[model samples]
Target: MSAMQLDAPQVYDVIVVGGGNAALCAALSAHKAGATVVILEAASREERGGNSRFAGTAFRAPHQGLAHVKTVLCEQALEDAERCSMSPYTPEDYRNDLQSTSHGRNDPLMSEIMIQDAWETIEWMKDKGVRWETTLRKYYNIETQKGIIIDLMSGAPVKVVGDGEGLIRDLYNAVENASIPVRYDCPAHELLTSGDTVYGVRTRQTDKYVDFYGQVLLACGGFSANPAMRRQYLGEGWDLVPVRGTRHNTGTMLRRAVEAGARPVGHWGAAHASPQDIDAPLTGDITKTPVIPRYSYTYGISVNVEGKRFFDEGEAEFGLTYAKIGKMIGDQPRAIAYQIFDQKTIYLLQTRYSSGRPIVADTIRELATKLDVNPTVLERTVQEFNAACPGADIGHFDPHHLDGLCTSSSLAIPKSNWALRLERGPFVAYGVTCGITFTYGGIASDDKARVLNNEGKAMPGLYCAGEIAGGVFYHNYAGGAGLTKGAVFGRIAGREAALRAKGAGGEAARFRPCKMEAAISSRRTA
Candidate 1:
């Protein structure tokens, strides 16, 4: 197909589409670099803060002191990436786990770039008022010799405070304070090109079409939340089964890029293993709170459609589990799973961990009946878990020994190693279902964050970062890597775009009418 052309006017140094982390980062970075910037966001008022906000809010990096553990995690991620590569995920393998998670479809050069500059980015975040719980050098250990990592928590030396909302708010505040213009409810429809170079974007506001010409950066997020787009990109049977993430991510900008001749880097999908009720719409009055505590402590067997356990119950990484559950959605009885725990579990979780909710039942049978699972199967699952207690050391169950589970820690007890036995009669069961968090596949770009056309040429004046750019990981995501990647790449794209815009003298070049018509005609014929 041929590229779609657009007529644009009113140029700025940089025009960033989308209001999420990547977009915001790009705009702020460009503005800080002394470029006039504008941000076009679809949402009038930020609701859930997009996927970045809803995330676990951790960033993963190699331990500074323990090179051995850091090296191990990196090697493992690379090995996994090599094993999972398809045609699109070329030269599959990564020196970083974060890159492996992107299926090796990410630009290796960019991945290296981000890894080298990660510490600096974290420091930049600190300077911007986001607090971290730890020092710049300290690492949060995961026990299994995974080594140390950085985190954003209060009271740490570099204390980077806030969740996704805090990060976004701070970024938005910085950009606004710098006098960057943000036009809400404005969505870019197409790229305006001049000769072989991209000049700017044609945008659609609520009431009419407006041309917002500049070096355009597409950060409008992924197609995971869009049911129709999911069906088109993933498969006929695939639907965006709702769970977490903002509703504004509909892949509109992705569609625009594809129409402009950009090639998507990856083909695989990624999702969050969410609670069952995640599909239900939030009541208007229901306030958003941290949901980690409930997820961290809840113990239950996850069964597939065949009524069998699929993986170790205590495993922290939920992507593979979610994918397995997602594959069973169209099967008989519409595959569902349940979480079985007791009152003690709920109470301990609520008292010790934050955000744990109650799901009480008078008895195991009542809980089974409430969850619509086979009573015998539920009983057997519990019995099996109990039989494997004190380490739950089933052959396949590889549990990460954290501080809470080790005998050395004050929080640890004799029964700490045991997966909650679920022996008490008065039980609580909550259902859980899987859903998409963000799209892994996106327009292929270079280390500078310039979007590449199908022919492997960078589209001048057009760039992208965050979920909109792909070819980073092969499979499996390390906690906090997504947010880190978004910020890192957004910064790159913004700086490069600003430089390009400044060079272009603020007036976007115009495409020759004859060539533009020919390109459009060829598309119609194709």
Candidate 2:
């Protein structure tokens, strides 16, 4: 094997695969720990960050107070950061939330690791030149009372700086500062192993196989873009769903790992899906990683192919329960659903609505016809919905909170909260279909980030993190949790891999309690 200095390892201590956030964290952490590491990124330099690039808006990490937050943020943002809530989140709080969200099906140990280490790992990344901010940013909307609401979740609410792209760039810069080598367009084709004891990665460069031997850490993503894998694992119509993020996450490493005896866990065909804009492509664009999804569906109503409602639009908060509705829409007649809104609450929308033109008509019948649904069914459905609503007007609606306004008990599916009738003229509807994000199921890894074999024993010299290493999320995920988990476990995996490679540490390196230092760093990168 001709060594690709970042291309092929001549005598490296660690080989990190998939150069997204998780892989970057692993590479940087291993490098910091004195492991001569090389990163193998699938995409070329231009199309670098994987799913990690899609996130940056928010993450639920532990913080002591505004002071703790101001430490990583720029001095300019400190004033505004003090205004927002920077309350502490204990390990128990995070663990409980994880358990409740996954319905107790999440791996207990892995969840614990994610919760405990998230804060520390985030601080570590900051120490390595990554900047984080808590500055309240916003843009005014026509419908809001104040005209401008804080851009919390939509922008960088309380996560790393510059969102996902910013976070990745900083890490990449840190790698450069450390003089770490990264080989772009060189994906791992196979894991070189002897009797299940993995040793290195095999890749093809210029039509020839080259082996890079080292302790392998697979932070590569899951199979959101691979249709065959999606169909085989997730189910039928899953193949048609749009990829919400990167097209490069085709589950190649996952398949190779599974073939190499790694056990697959989580819901095979299950994924975190969304009712994406109809104009959105099957593979998302690199320039526009959506800042806002079509979450305003709850303010109006979602109708199915037969021109009727299937589930309650107001069952829960739109921001909280996207997975449930996405699944419902995915299970619908063509895996399609139209979010019907009227002129009354149209101004309440942001990026998702304003991004494209909507199907508009002066009447419900015309709008239904435009949406290709039975006009009579649509009219009748609206009439019934309006009749069921006690107070159906702009005056009674409240978008900021779940107002008690609702549809009457007579309707099949009641608009339980924020219920307003679509009675006004020029009704607008945006056709949407399910967009699959990432597969929840993956190779089982232990608390220390070691990929477990079929019998549940740790696969020596092998570690996994990010979306590829499943067990943390089962069906649904909190908005920023995936990013946090990737960083937390990625740090742990890299630390352990480096220690094991040098034979310098034992279990202490693999599974030690989180030690968060308040030693703040002053690095500004927006």
Cα-based lDDT for every prediction: 0.57, 0.75
Instruction: Give the poorly placed runs of model 1, Cα more than 4 Å off.
Output: 1-8, 46-49, 62-96, 99-107, 134-160, 236-240, 276-279, 282-286, 289-294, 303-307, 315-335, 342-357, 361-363, 388-420, 506-526
User: Residue 426, candidate 1: how far off, in angstroms?
Assistant: 4.0
Model 1, 524: alpha-carbon shift in Å? 18
For candidate 1, what is the TM-score? Answer: 0.74
Clashes of 1: 27
- Candidate whose lDDT is highest: 2
TM-scores for all predictions: 0.74, 0.86
lDDT of 2 by residue, 1-526 (tens): 4333223234467889988888988988898889989998888888788887776345666666555656767556676654454445566666766776688899888887777777777778878887777634422243343434332332113566676678778889998998999888887888866556777777757665556767889998999989888988878788887888788899988988989988888766578787777666778675554643677787788899889898888865554567656778888898888889888877766544677668989999998888889999999998899888876455766665567788889997888887888888789888877877778988999988999989898888799999999887766766567888888888889988998888834432332121101100111112
